[model samples]
Target: MAIHRWRFVGIFILLAILGGAAMVMWNFIGLLLVSFAMAYIIYPLAGYFSGGNRKAGRKYLTACLSSVLLVALPVIYIMIYSLNVILQWLIENFGMIQSGSFTEGLKSGLDSAGFGVVSERLGSELGRLISSATDALWTQVTQPTWFLETSISLALFFVATFYFLYEGPRLMELIKKHIPTREKFLHELMSTIDKIFYGLFIGHLLTSVIIAGLAAVGFWAILRPPLITLGFLVGMMFVVSFLPLIGPWLMYVPMGLWYMALLPGGTMPGILILIYGSLMLTIVPDFYIRPKLVRRDADIHPLLILLGFFGGPFVMGFKGIIIGPLVLGLAQAIVMLYIEKRHILEDLFKRL
Candidate 1:
């Protein structure tokens, strides 16, 4: 009994040590998880190009092209373009914003718009927030360690993402073979993931691009928002509009208010167009494009998409935006399938 007790304590000690080690290495683990998610999102296209193990050379080429064109370029473009727009906007408006009269003008405009109390509160909050952010930004810029760490993380992320995309299929096959689940259940799970991700990654990508272009053009043509800055903002909103407690309405409402402030006299037509344009961009994509594309590709219900998407971030944080819905959909599907296979409903009805 004494020897057995010693063995048990030793085992737990070893387990605790391993768990501590894992916790220390969690950032790298998280990066790998993110890489895997990205690779999974693009895997279907990679598989299509591979085409039944035609040639390794062909597979590599296709993966490279897909990663660059679909993932890399759009990301680079959004970041660089958005940064330039921000810098320019700041340079143009920095002095104006700092002026006392400009603050008074803004307050008067807010008063006119029936937001006097809220505006006062918001102004103080924004001032404090901005001051803190400026200090943080300066510290980060001056800190060599922060820059070095950031660079290393980015390097690791890209390298991991590349390899994951390039060799994801073989790894997946290995994983599936080793996964300790019945073949039928495993197949069902994979099927669910494929359907969910296909709709999520590819469908959302195309829809966001279309909506972004539409928003940029509409703002430029109708409301005449500073094309470069506001255009990018409107477009970026769609990409992240699915986030919980956030949406395009946040951006558009402020934008509409600003438009009114800029031209309080002749703003009625622009306001109408802004309203109409907002509806076109926000409503059409959520209702028509996303559902249509997702359903066409995955044959999943639109309600699942809504629940998984909007409800995901609340439960899962940013990544939960994808994983949350996927988990929910998978669980729901698996339960339904299990019940159907066992005649659970029929048995319950008979009992009733």
Candidate 2:
């Protein structure tokens, strides 16, 4: 027992040292991981298609892929279209509130509210800010095509995903050849990642989509930006929304700022006040509901899940959110493995 415990500590120390030494080789490690994550995601899809066999499986495989392609292609097209429309809208209205009359009116309103001195300070700040912002905005407006081209990452992501699905089994077997099988480490690793990727992580992603859809409709009905575009933007924030304060707040702050900025000049001040006041009341309920919905369904501790999420970025680089839970899952699996090993060893010793 003592020797085993010391061996565990020694192995942990050795791993830490090796990991630190490998930091310079991070890019190569990153590519390898991306391939693994992609293959891991795809293997099940292929298995589902192949029916775990070489016969009578290609037809099911084709049918599955056809269905996926049918839905995915149109959705991607619409997202691109909506993104273009919203970018155009912002370009058209970017400078609406930067004129002198608007500033003077805003100052007068602040004066009436007993914030005249504060308003002057804000006016100076606004002047400096808008000057920089306007230049940036003009550059962005003139390059809408460049903006669209940036979505190529999304294209890469889905394409990689598709290839992973098709070629996963061959890839995994190849990987197993390079890794040891004495501990079934590859199987254990996959088992851990499968739960994190397909279980809790997928649940959060789906929930983010639902929340964004609901929010866009709610905001459009009330605040009324380019409805489809705003919904899609907010929906996409699910990518970052789990991070707290920074995530959801990033989307909402813009929603409010734009609500006022885009309104009629005569009413801009009134709208700004209303927007801020309503957000102060509504934002709490908005963020509070999402976690409750997700955690309740997953039956996982919120703190546990949150810690896993924060720890993900540090450990797994970009894939940490998916990888974080896998790390935790593997830790649990390792503990179980050790316990089983201890039991078998004890039984063998007694028989001897």
Best by lDDT: 1
| Model 1: how far residue 190 lies from native, Å | 2.7
Tens-digit lDDT string for candidate 1 (172-269)? 77778886554455566566667666655556645656666777767667656675657557757675554324545666666666667655564774
Candidate 2, overall lDDT? 0.55
TM-score of each: 0.65, 0.50
Candidate 2 stretches with Cα past 4 Å from truth are: 1-57, 96-148, 169-187, 218-225, 232-352
Best by TM-score: 1
The Cα error of candidate 1 at residue 261, in Å, is 9.3
For model 2, give the 10-residue run with minimal summed lDDT: 293-302
> Model 2, residue 156: displacement in angstroms?
2.0
Model 1 deviation from native, Cα RMSD in Å: 6.2
